[model samples]
Target chain A: MEWFIAKIFAKYNYWISIILMMIGFYGIVAKDNLIKKIIGLNIFQTAIFLYFISLGAVKAGTAPIVDAEIIRKGYVYANPLPHVLILTAIVVSVATTAVALSLVIRMHQEYGTIEESEIIEKSRDKGMTWT
Target chain B: MIVSIDLILLFFVVVIAIAAITLRDLLSAVILLGAYSFLMALIWVELQSVDVGFTEAAVGAGATTAFLVATISRTVRWEKK
Candidate 1:
């Protein structure tokens, strides 16, 4: 394939993450349903997480377990810093999803629909103008 | 070898993510998110972050999917558009 011969990417991870991030961003910005927006948000977050973890990868590196054997063998451990931050980020993403879902629940209860456009129209009809 | 496992996994992840965003059935998208998260965990492991992968499996794939399913059941199964 001309695509492969093109050598379009040497580091595939970053490009993959960027493509995923754009998909998520499009979902968040263009989708009509609130649930889809949340899904998009999750994808975007995961893209960022992947980018960070991939940045920390080193050739022939092992997991950052810090064992004696690894030290004696002089193994280069994958950078642990990004992993720790991503751990926190994943937990936070879950929390954000929970909160957003709960809010969507309440929005459906009040407006009888989860479509963002319909919700906005309803609010306008009800004279609940944003200030 | 022309392709590595990383490229394969990343390609699959991108395909699933696109499907998830484009699908009209909300429930199907939620399920696709679970798959995406699982593949993401595998990639993390492949990248030599075992602990991060473990957390992604437990939290992203497991708990997030459960929460989304519950919320979807309470709300709607289909998107307006």
Candidate 2:
């Protein structure tokens, strides 16, 4: 039973990551509100982060730090490269979110509504008609 | 090692993602999205990506939530639905 449970858990983690990514994608594509779109974008980006971090896991691996005792025993440790890459990715995601939010705010001020359909309608009425 | 905890975490992530996107209320969606991020962070920690987990907790669960709430305050809470 224990082995079965472990196998199930390991398999389910990957599935969960995939489902989160898809849901985030759906939100980004289907949501009408500008802010909700941003939320979805965040979700999508976070799902990728989760995926990458999960990929870095190594069972029974120690921290990447080198200790004298572990060196003597010649034991391997988990790689820290992925962790460093993810730190950079997180910063990039935050910067992107900030810029997107700023644009949304500007759009709201100009159109007075953040709904994508309403914005399109208003633009059409104004003879912009770029939809 | 029983992996049921990981499965439960995955389940929570899925449920929160669904709630985040399907809700008519924008605030609710934002909150659920934050919850989703937090669960993802927990998964990262379980996977032994402490640095990534820290960043996810900080930016995903923290700043993103703040930004969404602030944006919602400046706009309507729900759509026509």
Candidate 3:
């Protein structure tokens, strides 16, 4: 029991992120609504961001801002590389969400309903096969 | 401790995530998703990624939510069961 607890404490951040990732995966796979799916995608993306940020964490570390005093003492800083990468990721995520919402809007305009099953049914009536 | 706080925030994030998906009302779900994004921004800041956190707060909490709400207004409000 002690070993198990120790392991959990040592790596609980990863465990939590894994749980979140699984939840988002379930949402993307099981949910029928497109909006829910988009939200799920966001959750998944955030979880990934969480995991990346956690990977960059350091014990007794400060932010990556530079200073002469800190340089003299060899102060450790949190990884700034992940921060930069995740900035790009955030922009991409927003762009993707916008495009997805616009697509959803277009689908609603075409079909008059946003439900996946209803859209599939309507498409079938129009002699379109599931692709 | 920071670890405990992180765990607690993670718990809330998970709960909000589940609620965002399971909620019957689409508007409520979108709002909840925005809240989730804000909480995530907090976590990123706590992790010392303030730049990422700022972007998340701006894009995730602000732009994404607005886009979702606009889409909701243009589309159906309630999810069909």
Candidate 4:
């Protein structure tokens, strides 16, 4: 039963991460709203984070902290580098989200709506082409 | 080893993602996207990356969702088909 649980946990983790990523990408591509696109972007980035964190796991490993006693006993420790990188990634994600939301707000004020299709339609009508 | 639980979780994640994309309501899509993130975080936790899992929970499930919802509230909530 324990072995079954472990396998289930590991496989589930991988599949969940992948599905979230694909969905996020689909949202970004298929959604017409700028805000919704940003949300999808966040979801995509988060799936990557989950994948990396999962890769860092070590079975039966303890925290990376150097406990004097544990060191003397020579116990295995989990990798800490991924954790550190993830912290940085988290900060970057927050900053990106902020910038994206701000851009959405600006788009709303200028275009009067946040729908990508509507904005494109209006711009096309204006004959002001911008790639 | 029964990998069934993970398969179930994976199935749910896929369903949520599909729902998020297929829904006409932008608000519902955003909410489902948030649910997707939360599920991803749980996967991270199961993999034993406590720190990464915590970060996902905070930034993905919390901050990102809030940002999306706030932006939606300030703009239109539906896309015309």
Q: What interface RMSD do all candidates show, one decimal each?
A: 1.7, 1.8, 1.2, 2.7
Say what the RMSD of model 4 is: 4.5
Better of 2 and 4 by DockQ: 2
> Residue A52 in model 1: shift from native, Å?
0.2
**Structure candidate 2, residue pairs in collision:** none
| Candidate 1 CAPRI assessment class | medium
Q: Which candidate number would show the highest DockQ if scored against the true structure?
A: 3
lDDT tens digits by residue: candidate 4, B1-81: 124554666677778867776777888988887787788667656555667767777887788778888888887788677
> Which is the leading candidate under TM-score?
3
By summed lDDT, which 10 consecutive residues of candidate 4 chain A come out lowest?
A8-17
Itemize residue pairs with steric clashes in candidate 1: none
Report the C-alpha lDDT of model 3 over A1-131, residue by residue, as the tens digit.
99999988798778778888988898889888899889989999888988888989887778788899998999888989988988999999999999999999999999998888888999999999863
Models ranked on DockQ = 3, 1, 2, 4
Off by over 4 Å in 3: none
In model 2, the Cα lDDT at residue A104 comes to 82
First chain TM-score for all predictions? 0.91, 0.86, 0.93, 0.85
Of 3 and 4, which scores higher on DockQ? Answer: 3
Q: Model 1: DockQ against the native? A: 0.72
The residue-by-residue lDDT of candidate 2 on B1-81, one tens digit each, is 126677788778777778777788888888887888788788777777777777888887899889878877876788655
Q: A42, model 4: CA deviation in Å?
A: 1.7
Note the Cα lDDT for every prediction shown.
0.93, 0.79, 0.89, 0.76
CA shift at A17, candidate 2, in angstroms?
2.1
